[model samples]
Target: MNNTYLTTEELAGRIKYDARTIRQCLKDSVLLEGKHYIRPFGGRKILYIWEIIEEDMLSSAQSNLTIPMANGAVWHG
Candidate 1:
């Protein structure tokens, strides 16, 4: 897996998200530590793994295609 490590600003440009939003909102909520990002040398700087983020983003989007039914079931169309 060729994982691309991206800075917050670089990722923001690629994903069309504001750097502040990525730092404040998506940091610990959607983008998890160690899994989606890494703190090199245990420093404050964060490097996001683009491949992992893309995979998760696509997977989540695909999952969202499934419709929830009232009878406790999902409808995939």
Candidate 2:
């Protein structure tokens, strides 16, 4: 698979985000389980897959996509 495994702190360092933020905010909302991370042996410890994360980050950045606004709001980009 050639996956680079990383801890929460390590991923935070690579992505320049707070580890707390990654854990509290971006875990399921952004970084999905089994895709960006895995709980080996169905345990508590989570290992982040760095290659997948890095690839997704770069690909998403390259795509100029925007979040759909609500409440009759609009995006002009």
Q: Which candidate tops TM-score?
A: 1
TM-score of 2: 0.81
Worst 10 residues of 1 by lDDT: 59-68
lDDT values of the candidates?
A: 0.94, 0.92
Cα lDDT tens digits for candidate 1, 4-68: 99999999999999999999999999999989999999999999999999999998888779888
What is the per-residue lDDT of model 2 for residues 1-77, given as tens digits with 9 covering 90 to 100?
A: 68889999999999999999999999999999989999999999999999999989988876755567887775544
Counted clashes in each candidate structure = 0, 0
Stretches of model 2 off by over 4 angstroms after superposition = 65-77
List the candidate 1 regions with Cα displacement exceeding 4 Å.
67-74
